[model samples]
Target: MTMHNMKLKLTKVVAIVLLIVSHSVTANTGQPNILWLVIEDMSPLLPMYGDSTISTPNISQLANEGVVYNNAFSTSGVCAPSRAALATGLYPNSFGANNMRTSSNTAETGLPKYEAVPPVNTKMLSQLMREAGYYTTNNYKTDYQFKAPKTAWDENGIFAHWRNKPSNKPFFSIFNFTTTHESGLFEPYGIRKLEQRHYFSSDEKKIALLPNDHRIKTNEETTPVHIDKATRFPVPPYLPDTPTVQNDLWKVYNNLAETDKQIGAIVSALKNDGLLENTIIVFYSDHGGPMPRQKRLIYDSGLKVPLIIRFPKGYKAGTIDERLVSFVDFAPTTLAMAGISIPEYMHGHSFLDTSNERQYIYAAADRFDGFTDTIRAIRDNCYKYIRNYRPNEPYYLPVAYREKIPSMRELLRLQKDDALNKAQGQWFRKEKDDHELFNVCNDPHELSNLAYIENYKTKREEMGDALELWLADIKDDPLMKERQLIDKLWNGKTSQPTTEAPKIAVQNGKVTITSETKGAFISYRMKNDETSPHWQIYQKELPIKQGILEAIAHRPGYIESAPISLAIDAD
Candidate 1:
């Protein structure tokens, strides 16, 4: 026989032995299933958080049955950057993902469309879970500043769910609710028809296929009004108390209520699946509230979000955790809960182990759409320190997208008319101080800047030093130009790079796969059929296969390589 035919015969025998070993391994490893019920652009506005402006029964139930984290904060005020931190357990600034919406508005910025390239060895949190034998699913928002690698999750589409996973395998599923997003505050608001999917059964046939637009664009008359128009709203000092503002607040509460109902549906699904007791349900927002000043600023109003973690068998139920938790902590904490070892490279500490609880949290605000600004902040339990790199720049950035909200337009109109009060007009200041400090407990609105005060001098210096240390530790240059940053990320390349295709080698009756690209992750399938098959992350050399082995490679920020196939015929 030829050398190739003899090698194939030997590999076929090895494959048979390996297949038996793989099937003998237990499918269920007794790992806890993790379900993240993520919401968009919300704050602690529910009754559990001391703001009873809106009743959110579903979320309240979660709080009652879970530990409510009173001081959970996002690393960034906006969703994309904050999500990047959550996905990788690293601050967005650490990997140049701090800029909001890095993949869009290239023409306006006069820059190339770029993705945030994380450190070479950094793997997404979901990818780590998949490596630990979890069936990961995201249903399905992935605004992580970079396209997720194919090995990141088992399923990552709108229809993705724990129900789709193998019956015996544990799952790590994420369901994002966008009903409470910033666009919900737009005029002529109607409920997003797509959100009705949350109310539908998980059965694919029963789920309605809807348009991808999750924004409310129809007339207000077409939607059900959950909040009374006559209801009084507690307007913050930054926003004027006007009928227009009040109407927007009504929409906020109405949308929040809708979000609660959607949460109820998801919780019911978990219980119905007979996995409620075996699952750990975590509910949190991507960032903070969606209003103009709240959505993109680095203040408590923008960064602080509600976090509730319901452990299996009601572990620590109804307990309140006031530890300073940042978005970066999500990944490590989830890994700890899954009985998986947290990677050494992750910047976040697992909050589940309270031995090393953080005393402070850091946040950043960078470019939002076409506008660019650099602001960094650090907060402890009571005081918050804000450092504005461009003190000459006005706090009010005229972002066109934010202008869609009626309250934002109202602020501009009031500003033009010079009708705003001292407190309401603080946001429109032409210039800011180089540094500002606030006693958040005394002044929750952050209206009173105490940086120049005599009594708080010591506190100011301490916070400033802390902020500096954090920035240096993270290797973040807040003043770097976006274009220069892009070049650095691409290693001075004029165009984006693609991951090198993975190569397969057969030696000693073992199949080994590798990629030439540095830090590239390899994913492969062992099927001869030229159809879409589940891609498995290659962790080690596989027992020789006889039919076909297909593999691909991907590194964050670089384009994924095309799949290469190797066919080995049996004798």
Candidate 2:
């Protein structure tokens, strides 16, 4: 061959080598998309958690291919406070969000309606993901004890999905399944027709029909039941072993089956888009079980939840992680998974970092509806310590909302007739002990209180001292009056404060926006109205364009500022 021909062949080989190297670099450095499947009012009751009474094939498959967390817990036993901790990476007690239903029933409590206010620099988890160039979405639930700022999500309704995001950007999407919620146990039980989406394919017709169907109520006779009524379920000692309690237990399992199907449908969509291999899938409940004592109590049945995480390429497949994880750790974990920096102000350290393993987890319980009580708990691998600030208050509070469940009514009936056994009557006691400690490893139901027992005195005192140190670290005043807490959150104001309008400046054919309100972030759209699609988070100056530029400012716990528009002329 000629010398010139040999030189051309070597040049072609070098070009091909460089091309392969460039592709590998891009694939390794790109962010992985995240999907969160958050279910409501559920515990670690599935077959994956050793409860084989009900089969959840979809969830079991996830566990087989991912890591199963044996010790995941929520910050609170209830939803609002737990969700607040998940969103902020801070404890609810640290921000005055420990109480349930802070934004409603003002007349019943004789206190003004208020929202929990976190530190000024804190941002919602989704908002932080957005600032890091991710398209964030939430499917319809934002009960974080404060109204979510407009800058939090790109799409935040029933129709929100990762499909609506730009093709080039990575996505962080959440889908909340309410099928297993506590309200589902109400009388005249029937599943909502909206859940029918789980049974059908994700075609255009199914998507279009969901929004127009206002008849959420359906016939109980026609609804599908996964568990038979005759199936005998293991009843807790605190609850009566009657048919009424068994039937409620049946409903719980059936609801979980339905939710599993819904989760399968969403996962199918991700696979169909060919993004499954590049995404991180997380499945967990907002809190725990929804029965009478389980919903609001700070026991293991209420605070412990099941967590499964499937990483890309099946990393750590079929492994079980026994580290103590809390709801406060969720925000930092997600940020870490996406290769973003975790904020220094966040109270939680990422579980992905093996060096940051926790020695203990904590939880709290406060007001439920109009009634109020103060309880705090701390747990290690084996023991749990709970302290009751209101020792004079009865253990049982008459919450009207919880009464809708048939099991709750059954408990009430047994108590009135004096037919409850000693074990079952523990919850109906007239008053509570000042301190309670339990060896959770042995008494899973927390049946025996070991605070006064001399055998466990050393362990009890050790846990008590740790709890006090935690309270001091967080600066939480759990004994403060509700009215006084509200005053502090609002800065002694009678009404909520509004964010100041954003100011826009134009110079050198570039535009910048700012707000006078401290910690307020701006959102803008170069289009028609506030209802327009995709209000972009203002992170940097943009080149001036010819259109109506609408913008608004917002800070969490404050009313959004009035929108302002700017008109730009053509050159």
TM-score of each: 0.92, 0.92
- Give the per-residue lDDT digits (tens) of candidate 1, residues 387-463: 99999989999999899899999999999999999988989999999999999999998999999999999999999
Candidate lDDT values, in order: 0.85, 0.84
Instruction: Name the lDDT value of residue 269 in candidate 2.
Output: 79
Please report how far candidate 2 places residue 171 from its true position, in Å: 0.9
Residue range with the least summed lDDT across 10 consecutive positions in model 2: 206-215
lDDT of 2 at 548: 92
The number of the candidate with the highest lDDT is 1
- lDDT (Cα, tens digit) per residue for candidate 2, span 245-340: 998999899889988988888878777778877788899999989998888889988899999998756677899999999999999888877767
Candidate 2 accuracy as TM-score? 0.92
**lDDT measured at residue 249 in model 1 versus the true structure, 0 to 100:** 90
Clashes of each: 0, 0
